[model samples]
Target: MDFLKLPKRTSGNRTYGLTSIADFGTPIGRLTNILDDYSHIIDIAKIGIGSAYITPNIKKKVDLYKEYNIKPYCGGTLFEKCFYQKKIPEYLTYLKTLGIDWLEVSNGTLDIPLKDRLNVIEHAKEEFHVIAEVGSKDCNLEMDITKWKEEMQIFLEAGCEYVITEGRDSGTSGIYQSNGQVKSELIEELVKGMDVKKIIFEAPTSKHQMFFINQVGPNVNLGNVKLDDVLVLEAQRNGLRSETFYLEDADANYVNQTPTH
Candidate 1:
């Protein structure tokens, strides 16, 4: 059987075209079932905001993600909580015990200074692969595009493997308007001003996912994806969904071909 050629995607432990799932306390059995089917396309599983501390069988869940070669780490908000309590050292120790090697250094809900955050990133880089996040989670908070670009660059220089643009799981903040529409102008400027491959845009909805895939091609790194949306997102990425069916790489001839009996 022949398959139609679709848009090519980065595969097998991708650095780009990453799909990061936000795990909000999925049961180990359910998570294992999901990974068995979709682990090839899933790169990162973020134990959503402070839940890792309270979730049952946390070690087993983390180890399960690792077994499928997915990098599982606690959410940035958890890091902020640790920072607020001045327990960052203890947080690192806790993560080490869980076999987590990726860390998200972010200041979305907290007011940690840029210098302090960079210092943390630099220090954390020695032991973990850091992915720093920029922008606030509050929809009412406004941030300058110039500052966003500058901070992302500095984070990369500070040894962050990727810098996340903080469109929260709701898709209503940071790189998005209060109504969940993307800040297109801001995104355009960001794409032009930096190495897009190093930036992960949090796109939790179908609309958000399609927009990023269309704007940055299928290989754009996206985060905050729900576990259930994984397969649909991959379908959209490869032009298997209506949203991305007209991607540039799609074959025009296939559409125009005459039918045969």
Candidate 2:
């Protein structure tokens, strides 16, 4: 394989085309175990969905994430609950007190109005870095491209740095099937005529990661990745490994084999 044929992939500590991980296990111990080997590869560390509540030493973990320069933030479900419970402002303020500079605002489990959602983003930005999510947690929720575009625009304009696409924790359910497969036609259409760079797709499965890297190129943003999948996902993104790139190389070699026929 010629070296130039392979595409160049982005390094970590990136803003755009970024990748983030979810910390779903024991907060401090798990963090120690992962960083003991893989901290340099990770960009963002998420205390996924109220895990901070379960882990009483939120401040300790927050400091650990920062010690590695890995941004620590809460998951969207917590933000949704706070906003729904009329404690949105309090949540943002409390996170700041704990040395957290990032927060996620999502409407996954609730129906937040477009204006209200943007308002949360703005309020969050006053004290923290904000990233908004685009998806529904309910299985009954259907795809509405118009709604997606509108919400994306509002969030981006509200000073949120990134608007994440809905792939759920398993990369399924909202924009995927029960078997954890993404609806490719819909994914292509969703990315069509839109800013592909600003959105992060939550792709927890290898198949989903391969598909996105194929369609949107290796530099696509992804989230909800398990800590152990870090190296594998990075290889896929950079064309370093993964069968998809191998197959592509094989096909190209066949086509260019001196063209005897």
Candidate 3:
């Protein structure tokens, strides 16, 4: 039985539907190995938080992803550093020089005023397609759902591409309960009036993955996915995973046997 339909998405270079990979300094050769195998399954490769800065072979990594037709975006923490140091212009310029076509502007770690955040999004939009993030790294900073939803709306209006929900490197932080499950009530609240396509849920673990996929569907956009797990995630998208898809399979057969004809 057909239990899942992977993102029969609008091809690569898509705006709404995207599969992003987080590069945790996997060697360029490894990147090529994965890309060569499933380039069509991947969309974006984010060099998570200045890892490339330490690696220093930035150009080679950038070329490899682009060659495979994967758009490369930098983590927002790197952008935050540049913004805090008043080097926003130079950072934006440097991103262009390195052949980075997409970027993330987030205040996950710092206090960025609304106007300033919009300016950063606008600034990035001039050259790079920007995915603005709307969550704090500090869980103590209580999340105001209404405010976050409003800010996401404004971002969409301002020509930004997506509003990435925070999952951090470890999915146990913001939005997710300490046990690594997303707060179901909060997720209902967040998705209420938002365009589901524009909100990227960061489901880093299998539990988080099941929660979000069960909450939404196979088409839900997820982020912070490890480079190695892209195909696994894709399998989940197709109900190829025994745990998630098997349930979907049973349900399908049950429905088929129901009195219809």
Clashing pairs in 1: none
Off by over 4 Å in 1: 248-261
Candidate 1 lDDT, tens digit per residue, 162-233?
A: 999999989999999999999999999998888887889999999999999888887778999999999999
**Of the candidates shown, which would achieve the greatest lDDT relative to the real structure?**
1
**Distance (Å) between predicted and true CA of 73, model 2?**
0.7
Local error of candidate 1 at residue 97 (angstroms): 0.6
State the TM-score for model 3.
0.88
TM-score of each: 0.94, 0.87, 0.88
Q: Candidate order by lDDT, highest to lowest?
A: 1, 3, 2
Tens digits of per-residue lDDT for model 3 on 44-157? 788997676676688899999889888888888998998899998988888888988788888898889989989878766877888898887775666777887888889889
Compared with the true structure, what per-residue lDDT tens digits does model 2 show for residues 1-261? 665455544555766556688888555786688787877767787888877766787899889889987888888888888888899878877887889888888878888877798777766687778888887877667868777777777788789888888777866576787667677776777677466667888888888888877777666778888888988887776576745565333323221122110
**What value of lDDT does candidate 1 attain over all alpha carbons?**
0.89
Q: Which structure is stronger by TM-score: 1 or 3?
A: 1
Q: What's the lDDT for candidate 3?
A: 0.75
**lDDT per model vs. reference:** 0.89, 0.75, 0.75
- Is candidate 1 or 2 superior in TM-score? 1
